[model samples]
Target: MTFQKISILFACLFALNTFSQFQVDADVRARFEYRHGFGNLFPDNTDPAAFVTQRTRLNVNYKLEKLTVLMSFQDVSTWGDTKQLAIGDNNNSFSMFQGWVQYAFAPTWAVKLGRQVISYDNQRIFGGLDWAMQGRFHDAALLKYKNKNFIADFGFAFSQESQRNENTDFLLQGAFTYKSMQYAYLKKTYNKGLVSFLFLNTGFQDFTDANNTIVDGVNYRQTTGTFFKFPINTINFEGNAYYQSGKATATKDLSAYNLALEAIYKPNNTVFGLGFEVLSGTDQNGSSKNKSFFPLYGTNHKFNGFMDYFYVGNHANNVGLNDLYAKAVFKTGEKSTLLTKVHYFAANNTLINNADTYLGTELDLVYSKNLLKDVSMNIGYSHMFASNSMSLIKSGRSNNNTNNWAWVQLIVKPTLFSNSK
Candidate 1:
């Protein structure tokens, strides 16, 4: 069915259930961003220019006793450009992001069907792709069960056809989590600290294009990870490690591993955080050539420095990174805070091994404040310094070696109704 028809149906459903044994909630967000760079350093190197983009999202959630339904739609477009295409259009006009339904058979058992986001275990093996302008969604079915700190999940997808691909491919995955300790950390004092184990398996079906050429065989991918959070004194410490095996676009078996550690200290209105991460690279003999790390469930903005050079997932393998990050936050007033972050990244592998290494450093500054009740604003700036071997230098490309960008954002949230227990 068309989006318009679906929207109308939802509106009717919501109106008809005003007094039923169900509850409904909605959230809306609008964002605008302006980005300009001084260099044409990457493969898509073009003329240096500036542009603004806007994003609007609507989220609707309905819960009836143990059953739930979720729907979200997002529109993205460049400002002041009638002829310009959407920011990241693989093909379609406004993307139909997520539409799903979930049903619970028992208090601890449930199943979900339809297009939705599949995020599990630190988001290394699976994630919602929230960084993109339109983000990413998958068509699949998921089953979940949780009881007394034990959780198990199973998921399967029959297709991976983005708007660009007319043919459909299949994928499947499964994961499990167990809570080992109760009240092991400050954040979980009421429930205890928990240990989690996760496993995922995915496969894609072989299909030919309209040209009748054999596309490829069904590729298999797998991931496993463990996570723990514990408190030391007034500080909280969290760490995770994961390993992944899969076939990349080249059909070559790829192997990768990642390790992350984070410490957060919170005292009254002040907060401080430190993090360290290491990613393994593929061996030279083409053995386990997929030396790329999976970020899993991290707040991408909080890691990889402020420049967002690494998390963009552009030159993944070429930009071997050993990153160290630190941040400090202070509440200036009742409704304002100042945050500063610094990142230092150096080449993990030999510079001579790959030419893409331009060891880099990034600095970020942000200030956030409440303008009024339910209204907030944020201002941020980032600066990146590229090393000699970095891709930012090309004669035909924009000559600016240093990259600088800034943005200002405003948000308004109004609640229709809320209940507290």
Candidate 2:
């Protein structure tokens, strides 16, 4: 059957259930963005100028007693002289990003089935990928339970490949969380603080040619991490560490690790934060390899300072990274706020023997305002500067030192209803 038929069938089924505990909610968002590149920063630049694009999202959720269903659809388009050159035609049209059903078996036990999002502790190993206009969703089943201060979760993902691979894969993950703030030294006084541990395993199944022959060996990856949050006065300390070992579909086995630390100080409407991260890389096991790292649960757009040059999962393996980030937020009034951020990133390993490894710097600014009681709008801009050692920005044999890029985005959101207990 077609997707529309399936959707209509589900809706009819829900309508037939005579339950007073049923509830429905919906949300929609629209965004317009403009991007410009200069000095050979982006590939295939005939005029090398600016462009505009638009995106719209609609989400519907239905709940009946302990069962909940969710679906999201998005539409994307571009315009202007450089629209085709900058945004590409592949992004045009509408698509479903997620569809899932969740069942709750008491306050502490729940299971989500169907195409859902599998986000775990710190998102170092698994995430929903919500930064993009059309975010990532998983086709999987997840089970979760929480008893008092302890929580456990497990998930299984099947029949898919990520942007970097061609093989269908499966993912298994387990995570645990301890919510007693008094047990950890850093979290003793913070009632809402938590400590979590996660383990993720990904394996490829039947990754072979159409003739039922194996072209590359089955791939496997294991990731383990611990994350904690501590609050002191108006400042909060957050940290995470992860170790990963994996072999790509056609590559040798590799091992890597990551470390992240941040301090967020929020005193009323104004907030200031700073963070540092490191990814380790060395010649281990007789292979000159690069260490892997995930930015974890942090908002990629907010942390990497909007230029989206690194840590967005675009350039993952070739270079290790060390990043320093800072942000400041100011409340302009009761209904408006202004935010700005800066990021400095450098390569942890040498791109070449003689080349320096400083990656680039980024600057971002955003303004948000509440236009009405339940309506809001946001505007943002970002700029990036490329260094001589940044291989991703290089063209031919010359380092594109003059390369730079900028983006602007506007968003509008209106809420329908909210319930408070």
Candidate 3:
């Protein structure tokens, strides 16, 4: 809450370690938002939701010749929501955000173990969801390889509710959750552009049988994709294509894909972007199988407009989406920048009930400025204009009211301790 308290906390963390190379850092973010139409559509009668959220983090790193270790603790909460709880209570409403260790056996091979975040090229399928108050992390193991122009990484994980308990049969905590997962990513850099390939496999736990009896089964899906980026003169081009197959949780056949391309031009201090993206949709009238593409664990908010009107969890197996958008960023000064984006959204497939393909349009505006060496401020506003098809998709959900959102956020990351020597 104050600089003195933060310093004391850092000192306490340092007291626990006696390493040759150690560093401690602190990160704090506070955001106030007014959501007339946040994640969901608003009804005409219901009032908009408004709140302030904050995240505080402290991280420590210790490195040696053969091993490297990191530990980060975080607290995420809404403003004025904890008045009923006592401080330091064992209620223990906290997270050990990240705890991991990496060991290098050779120059090109290393393994990292523990709970950490996974982010990849374009973050189209896997990402660190930093926008959320409690960010995303995975308990897994990763094997890494690095070289001059090539790199490869493989990750494996299995989620379970009880560990080392013989009575439990390795059951994952929640329904529709992955019981086990694995992925392999490889990348190669070329003279003109860089290309990367990814292969991810996920298995979900089965909980029921034909007779509605409890059972343990496995349903699996695999995702494969490639991402590329290159530069031509002042214009930079980028694109990606991904496909998914295998069976879904219900053992239904699954087939899906996503394709996107973008070109960015930066001349002087101003930048411009043009992009198009499409996700395949299921054919409701034709088959009993599912075909809608899910981005899996990617940062969906970065796409489909910041308003998060599409695929943020609302349209998983329904009609897919098509997005055509453009944006411009103007660097106002050395420390300030402004960005504006416009998007046109449509359904990827014709609706079985109504042949409507038109979804809606959205506009987003953002401004950011640095106030101190370690502090920055950001403000944003977004509005979505829904169509009749949107009403049909959101059927009985949204309040048929105006949809808009506004927010202001501040980020502070400070290096509490470091030994440059």
For each candidate in turn, the TM-score is 0.77, 0.76, 0.92
lDDT of each: 0.60, 0.60, 0.83
The Cα RMSD in angstroms, rounded to one decimal, for candidate 3 relative to the true structure is 3.2
Q: How are the candidates ranked when ordered by TM-score, highest leading? A: 3, 1, 2
Instruction: Give the per-residue lDDT digits (tens) of candidate 2, residues 1-421.
Output: 2466458746854563444333333334455554454323444433445656565665556567787777766665555423444533343366666788899988888988776665654555456666556665666677777676677777665553345445433332111111110111111223768888776666643335655344444556566778888788778888888787765333556578888899999888789989998875442123444365544333454345466665554445546678898889999988998888887978766565546668777777788888776566778766667676665424332344344454445555544333321
Best by TM-score: 3
Error of 2 at 91 (Å): 7.5
**What ranges in model 1 sit over 4 Å off?**
1-32, 38-48, 83-95, 121-125, 128-133, 160-192, 204-213, 249-251, 283-288, 296-301, 353-358, 392-400, 416-421
Task: Tell me how many clashing residue pairs each candidate has.
Answer: 10, 0, 2
lDDT, model 1, position 351: 53
